[model samples]
Target: MITPIYRVQCDGPGKEWLSLPEGHVTGADVTADNLIAAPTAKRACNWPGEKEAKRAAVGAGWRHAPDSDFKTWFCPACQSAGTRP
Candidate 1:
């Protein structure tokens, strides 16, 4: 299993805590599409997670790809890319 990246934060009572414990890795994949009429027109451009992920990616400097194959969750910039790795 992959070890999750840790996000440290100061607790309400001034204690440091690991917001993300571990083993929270994300995964993504794309599907095959074909359209002889137009190449660009067949592309999947509408990324559903764009709004929220972009904000987080801007603050974090870098972002990971979508967390699932279904476009359910993703970091900001990754969502902007709108392509699975």
Candidate 2:
């Protein structure tokens, strides 16, 4: 069975942090179309489970924004730069 992959999005301007690839499509092969369609952003904490992902994210200077409707994770650069909303 395929499990969900969790990735923490970084609200930073750093190219390194903003260029991380998002999770792969489940139950699908990596094709050219998919590769081109895959969305990428400033993200980290690529893990299989949410809890571990969040833990690692936090450990890596990511913070969970409680006010956002969706789960938003800000990277260290964003935090340091005051770019987080």
Candidate 3:
């Protein structure tokens, strides 16, 4: 079976500055690892093709940080205010 490998673009802060929301709860002991482990799916794209996915994400005002992992993406509002997750 050819399981399609769709690229998941997370609508959250880039890994470099990734962190949980101010009041987010994980039901576990708060730790550095977990604090930055959560990712929000507020806006996501599951396009099978990398180029197409990136095109769609960018079209929606998502910016890909060059220094971050490919999966990390910031929403339009965040990008405008230069905010981080």
lDDT of each: 0.29, 0.52, 0.49
Native-to-model Cα distance after best TM-score fit, residue 59 in candidate 1, in Å:
0.9
Q: Candidate 1, residues 1-85: lDDT per residue as tens digits? A: 7533322222122222212212323333311121011112222122335553333323433333345332332333333455324
Judge candidate 1 at residue 46 and give its lDDT: 27
Q: Model 2 misses residue 49 by how many Å?
A: 0.8
Rank ordering of all candidates by lDDT, starting from the highest:
2, 3, 1
- Stretches of candidate 2 exceeding 4 Å from the true structure: 13-45
Q: Each candidate: how many clashes? A: 3, 1, 0
The TM-score of predicted model 3 comes to: 0.45
Question: In model 1, how large is the Cα lDDT of residue 67?
Answer: 53
lDDT of 2 by residue, 29-69 (tens): 43322221113543332467877656666655566567964
> What 10-residue stretch in candidate 1 is worst by lDDT?
30-39
Sequence-dependent TM-score of model 1: 0.19
Highest-scoring model, lDDT: 2
Candidate 1's C-alpha runs over 4 A off are 1-48, 63-85
TM-score for all models, in order of appearance: 0.19, 0.55, 0.45
